[model samples]
Target: METVDEVDAPQVRQCPECGATVSVHARFVSWCAACDWNVDPGAPDPDRGRLAAYRKRLARRYGQQLAEEIERSGQEARRVGPDGSTVLAFGVSLLVHSVSGGLLLAAGLLIIGGWHTRILPVFGIVLLIAVATLLPRPGRLPKGAPVLYRADAPRLFELIDEVGAAVGTTGVHAVALDTAHNAWVSTYGIRNRRVMCLGAGLWEVLSPQERVALLGHELGHFANGDVRSSFVMHGALRTLARWYYFLVPHPLDSLLDLCVNTLVFLPRWAVYGLIVLLDGLTLRASQRAEYLADAGAARAGSTVAAVTLMDRLLIGDAVEAHLRRASMTAPEASGGSRGREAREAAERELWERLAARIGSVPESEYERLRRVSARRGHSVDDTHPPTHLRRRCLASAGPHPARVVCDASRTRSIAAELAPARARLARTVIRYNAD
Candidate 1:
């Protein structure tokens, strides 16, 4: 009654126990509908020696490159004659203003001269409106954002401070925890206040030592002066793009809108090009900053820990995918609390599945992950380099044990502290979605 199916093709297989047909789609594993007998062909055994050698070569080659980048970052940091991206962003902003001003001036002269007076003023107004709309406002976090603050999680705050001090940068103004599976540090408020954001989902999966490495990498941005420059450059470029697109005249608008759109079309097009140019000029520096952060992680934790952190971070993607898939299923007759309980259960399940899979990732699969990451190195607009490069760089730096270590009890306490905030944040999310 047993039958075999080809890999990656939908084929019918007969159950050995009950002789019922079951459709199998995947390659690595298959199952039966009517019987529980294993129909798995199992994954092939990987050559551990070859994988070890291959990774060793990658570490040796890319590690040298990482060392060069570290030197470059240090040299550039010292030489500071206005950051290249800042200069480019400013220059582009000035160019946009100049072009807009020039057009308005010409329109004013035309109005004063009584040549095409009506048309000129209308065109001038459109350009002015475009300029006004495009000016960059200070960035702000979303309204009713779900965040766990310092007062709520003092232990986590202490952990952050301890990690920051060890990494030689302890100027944190605030710390917030969210549901995301990524950690970052950014500036908030008009006064350029620095804040650290840690992901609760990420915390759930990582060991205490790995958390230290994550904190180190994020805090390292401040130490390397990446925060302010990135905020300025990214903000400026985004504003420019906004302004450029705002100038596009819609057909539904009156004829004047079309005419105005025509007048500024070339300049708007030029703005797009300038954004592309700025991206190219700044990409290498951005990638180097990522390497420096990886080095920071290695310095704060062990090289093994840093690399493991990178691998574990990849698992977050899978967790998100599973969550999305689970959301597609029809809900049972569940009320509010029941729905919330169900969601929490799903999250717990996803974390367990992700952790188990990551914990036992084979060498061959790890190699495959590295290749995929390397192939998709930083895109033109990406702020970080490929995961493989980061992993390689951390491996190259060699291992350094963490300066601060925490026990399982400490980690659990932090999670417990976040419980109330997590509930509040969940309510905020539900309210937002309802609205």
Candidate 2:
């Protein structure tokens, strides 16, 4: 069978905007090479929504500032320390937790004093509920989440550990796999055990060195001194968000309900304002931490590998769309003994098909994606700075040799270890699309 990158013929077309001749590929965007028309076709404007507009402003203001700073200082930009913004973030966090504690104390006192007055207990119960709603809860992994322990995937764990060491942090306790096209590291449960979550969609497309870059970036979070990720601040942010959720008025059915909602309106907006304020205070520091983490990526996987990883991320939308198309078009088996065998065969082939599809993307397509991203100021999400800025920063940094190298033999071993997860996630994608 012909691969995705193989085109029998190039279709010539005129650019609607510039009247320039363009060469169109079968599976890639066609644009006028001279005029650069349609280079970012159909991409939504990054400055669309209110929150998005705010984030875009932040990205421009801080992203440019940090990029310039990095250009001037080089590796010195990686050293982040307590500043006014971070201190304010911590202060707000303290205030939020204190409010929660006060509510708990008041509820306990009222409940204990209920022996003297029946109404006191009723009010205490209400206060207790409010306290529960306001309290910061530990993060929990979703039920039946696919988790890989060190024992089960020694080679993979070793790679992660080496990356972690390079990034100046201890390795994560566990690895979690999911179906999204992203990767992150978060502390889970009351003990705050660090777990690295890898999305199968993203993982399958990365080269071994890029995978090390990805790991270095994530593990760097623990060492990068992101104030927002600190326990106190993270909990406070969650608590305020929860408060806003509960305080928001529901649909009213009666006059009493209207009155109750009216009373809540101010508090709801107040919590929202606080959330915004806290986010603003920590925004700069967080963006800086991300850049520091990117430096870690370069340190662990070499500058070239890290920069290539960023380039790959620029085409994430294309990758996801390809996967979606594959999922939707996967053949369904007819009911019978033969059907089960056919289904299993298709499941087993899913990863291979996806790998081939992604691997077949040409260098020109990647270059186009980077140009589009630069134009769009694209990012993985609002939390991240623009991809163009990140790419520029990575390129500007001096090249460093890779600290953790995964040879072909170890890479194959790691692949073998992940085979079961690959199979399970492949079936999941197929079943989801079928439904």
Write the residue-wise lDDT of candidate 2 on 1-435 in tens digits. Answer: 763445524678888888888777888888766778878778476465565577667766787789889988765257757888888889888998999999999999999977489899889999999889778777776456689989989989999988989999999888989877889888888899988999887888889899999999998888886888888998898899788778778788899889989999998888888888887998888889889989999999988889998887876776678667767876665556776787788788877777777787767678778887877778888778888888888988788899999889988999999989888887778753232
List, residue by residue over 324-398, the lDDT tens digit for candidate 1.
544454244355887767756554454455455445444434444444455434111134555665676566554
Candidates in order, TM-scores: namely 0.67, 0.92
Worst 10 residues of 2 by lDDT: 2-11
For candidate 2, the per-residue lDDT at 191 reads: 96
Q: Runs in model 2 with CA error above 4 Å?
A: 7-9, 14-21, 43-53, 74-76, 252-254, 432-435
